[model samples]
Target: MAAPGPVHEALAALPLVDHHCHGAVTADLSAAQFASLLTEGAAWPGVSPFDSPAGVAVRRHCAPLLDLPRHAPPADYVARRAELGWQEVNRRFLTASGAGVFCVDTGYAPYPLTSPAELAAAAGATACEVVRLERIAESVAAGGVTAGGYATAFEAAAEAAVRRPGVVAVKSVAAYRTGFALDPERPAAPEVARAAGRWLARGGRLDDPVLLRHVLWTAVGLGLPLQLHTGFGDADLRLDHADPALLTDWLRRTAGTVPVLLLHCWPYHRQAAYLAAVFEQVYLDVGLALHHTGPARCRAVLEEALEITPFRKLLYSSDAYGVAEFHHLGALCFRQGLAGLLQDRVDADELSLGDALRIADWTGRDNARRLYGPPVSEPARDSGGPPTRKV
Candidate 1:
């Protein structure tokens, strides 16, 4: 490990802007619910997900924050979590993360969770929403829009959502729905109308490829920073197809138009890194991968992500969802992994200590600030845990 020094201290002191993440659970989770949050898999009866790396990492890291010893047994840790209850747990973890702004993706698993306003209030940070393109389309479909009117209705809804207060960007789960093998050109109006008609007739999920293409094109038209899930995710993603490399053609088409933020690039992070290296508008983050990798292995993931990517093209995100523990663990692992990697280079004289510190600030906060602008205010925690804007 790099010796405790100025570089480590500097990385620790810089507040993060969790640029891509989800709202935390508002209700206290049962042990099963909590364990479910730790992994992407479904909870199996009588099986302990706690035996996994993420489970063990949670016990190792989060235990101490809850006043338990490191590596507390799963039962002990879960029991203690129950004792403190939801609000305290959220406060303990969110405050500890040192995130000044949470750019929350509020589309997935939206219910029984904190809203952006609620998250900012509890975390004592500013919060901004990223409009989910597919979710908006589904909502528009659910309202019984006729085939011919679907395009107009969807467009109006997306525009209204973007214009809403505190909404800063748009997101697409194309990786989950249709994969990145999308046509770079915008879909024709007739083709989009046909796709929309078929999609509304089905009245279910919005996974049609033509319709999905149309959604992506519409999002580009909105002209906000667009986030795409490029790499690792739940079982819904076909890992091979979700590769960022597949999007190069689309990236080339969208160049100089909108900023494309790639989220949770793992196994394909190196590929995402390559894209970020070559594309001026491309940005990447290894958020979901970091927590599961834990501090021990996350350094390698971070190293791979940084290898070919420009320093400014890398962004920090927790990709946190459900429990606030993910938000905490993501930040904790990122800091440890990044600080350790840069400090090692500094020790080997591969990079100047000054360069390491500046790079750390750029990845941790500055890049996101440049992309999203400033938060509402540098809010501070008030009594009872409501966030208060700085004077």
Candidate 2:
């Protein structure tokens, strides 16, 4: 891909609406804690997390945002970050992300992170929440459910959670739990009750296949977009089973009823692209994987994702959690990767400059706006004033 040119400049200037992401950490982290957040794996004995692609990317892209030079030494970067503190670091990265809106998944938080409201305040943007289905199920189960009332209780919890103010969608980490290999048809009442009985009796995590399926369909019944963790997560996920293609049957059943967003489909991005091509409800984003691949190499992942995926079926997300740097890095890599790919087509005369810029807008901002509804206007780059919320 060519160096920064007109297309890259245009993309950099365009505002974004991050359609799926998580909150940023609120407190300063220790070195180990910070390193732990850099990768999906457990901290090892003597290895530096900075040795990886994601770590290098952080040093390269996020270092300068913190006022450090490019490729800053790991110790220097961490010390500089500590010196600035979380609030300043967060403000620098979140504002620099250029996202006018943040659609945050308010689950999977393991740290003292900012709330969607806090994140909105930090970035000077509007924020909406995406309820996680499993968390709701676990909450309901912990509230003393009986075998007979399990199905109704779960449905009620799911309904109530999604109905809450600011919840624009529902999400599931089923790939981490039962995977997508289960029956697509809604579980029978008796099966769900029995499963719940076993789970509540165990008083442990909710990996029950029946309960997981129930949560999914209940979310669908609520008539909100459903985001599923399809591929590339922490070690807990069975990567082989997390493929989006495994959910084909579920897609067929949920089609036309709800939008199904597949998140972080990395190795199976082509499969996700195919599903997006075939199913109107299916959509995708590579999220953290984009910037994790680093700006220079992320274009291939985007290329694979866009090969057959409809332009509208693609969306933007950072899937950023724990740290605000991801919010910046994800946007940076996405702009670099997408602009590089689109600009190449224009240079090759395969796409008109007008079409390339239009597609860029669609992927970066407009598509997310259409999917999630209008943003509450802020003092955005191109905005006349604070964007008014869609009633």
Candidate 3:
């Protein structure tokens, strides 16, 4: 690789605020378990995830950090990872990620994963929590709240969850639950009661559309930035329904209520960019997609996402769950992809150097700081290694 340009240098030095992500698995993973986590799909017979883009990316980008050669064989990579143990592996990658603040989603832990504080400690960074609204709602139902009392019980529970110290935001997996094609307006009390009754009786994951809308609207009332999963998730999601464009009416109705962060809009990135351009409260990050696209295609994904997005509306996040390699890979892809795009525009005279540099800082760090407030403690500057060159 050639030397990094000025924009690259600036981005390299900046402390990224990973505005949305999940905890890394603290336990050592077997090769098969690691492979399953690489792709959003299941590990089918006669197929290896290592041949896929994300799997190849781990070998190409993350192998060397484990003291193995770049593009190392899958067996070699997995062996080295186990030899180093999960803690040391996590320390190496999380430190290398250059993230100063991690806003961790404390929901959906099928595995025993690091807590926000543990993740921060491993990286020498600060941490904040993003309460998952659906989890809270589920707990309310599990606690045997009546349908008539579900509305008030859920509201109180959500409010209390956000009030916990270090909680900076809240999120909903509505895309996975019911998608975004529902009525835009908040449900009436009786409507919510009926919906809650049906959901409580069924007693499973919260998927009722009326209840989904109710939780979303309740999030609006909470007045914290809300993150929504938009596109390209596991096999459970219907791709067509995960489009951010489907939230048009909801965005319109909830204008100026709370900042709604659209997460991982890959196939619908163009739509997400449009939403960010038109709605003042809408923001986005192509986090989960970054590592999956890998370094080779990351720039193209970012270019499309930034096509019409207001500079302030684009934020950085890893959305990294399970493997620590994603923490490093997400940051690596983001820095390389974004710097390549902005630097080219500068070279083409389409953007001034100062503006490009400022955009890097805003997208990488400041925008998240402004939204989440300052970290619990100041972020460590040394975690990312030395800058490529001083800004």
Candidate 4:
């Protein structure tokens, strides 16, 4: 495949931005171990903190047993990891990918997921955007779902991160629960279970309309484009519950309200694209940085989303949790995909490279910046090491 035309090479040169990502959990080992417990290949039993791993599981659980191809870890991997940690990753993300701006997350976490102070210090006079959640999980637990009701804690945290100069967008995950349920007593797939994926489990019934109303209204009112986990929530989830079509009611009702940031839209790539076209507020952020999907799907999903929505309405993401490469890979996808897709059309000569660049930049950062906030000049690498992803 000629190495897919060197995605890294093209990405190393593009001016892009990542709109959605959890600031705390981007390390490979920690995340993998956790993921392993949650989703077993054939049947996701979910982590019970007791189950034993098989062959591959043993290797993954016991890192030493892992027979991985050797590549000297990044020159400053450990030290940098210890030093700035995620903040440093963000710093390097801007440095390595030439990304214009990026956003960080801070929701329901005990500690600030993104060090607002550190991010601001790092920005140091650049046109970057920085946004942090003042309150998100609070509202959800408080019997509501609007982004505004989600609570607006310290805008200053966002203000400070951008002090160094990088565009920022307020990052938020959807209201769905990411955890799953398994009936150890009933065997792997519990027949009676509804498995609503992560949110309510398969047992949820039509009576869930009340909860649905709260979530949809909350998201719509907040209006800061929410990144939802549509398909494949937990390993043991009822895949049917994760289907994007089921969210149609939420989509139709919230039509003019909040913008939907479709995360992991791959399993439903075409559906996401059509939604992007149908609902002006809805957008798609094609990703696999989370270890769920791979590169090819990432490329296809974003491409499809772009074909439908004004490229400006779309945004970039990595769903990256563990492994900074998620950041690296996502940037690469946009750069090369843009180049390849544009080259193929042969028609749309009117779609100047500049036009494409504008879309790239918008999809990359500007639009996010405008909708959320300006590019954060600083990123909180100084205030802390990596924020704990335990929750």
Q: What lDDT does each candidate get? A: 0.85, 0.85, 0.90, 0.43
Candidate 2, residue 99: CA error in Å? 0.6
- TM-score against native, each model: 0.94, 0.94, 0.95, 0.57
- Candidate 3: residue 329 lDDT (0-100): 94
Model 3, span 214-276: residue lDDT tens = 999999998888999999899999989999999999899998678899999999999999999
The local lDDT score (0 to 100) that residue 134 gets in candidate 4 is: 22
Candidate 2: what lDDT? 0.85
TM accuracy, model 2: 0.94
| Candidate that scores best on lDDT | 3
Instruction: Name the 10 consecutive residues with the lowest summed lDDT in model 2.
Output: 382-391
lDDT of 4 by residue, 1-391 (tens): 4343332344346555566554433332333343342232433455332132222222222222122222223222333334555555545543444555445554433323444334324433123222333243233334423333222222323234323433233333232432112111221222212221223333332123223333334344433445565654445445555556566655665665445666666666567777777776666766552233333444555556566666655667655433343444456555656555654442357566556555655566555554444232222321212211111
Off by over 4 Å in 2: 1-3, 374-391
Model 4 reaches what TM-score against the true structure? 0.57
TM-score, candidate number 3 = 0.95
Candidate 1: count of backbone clashes, pairs at least 3 residues apart or interchain: 0
Q: How accurate is candidate 1 locally (lDDT)?
A: 0.85
TM-score of 1: 0.94
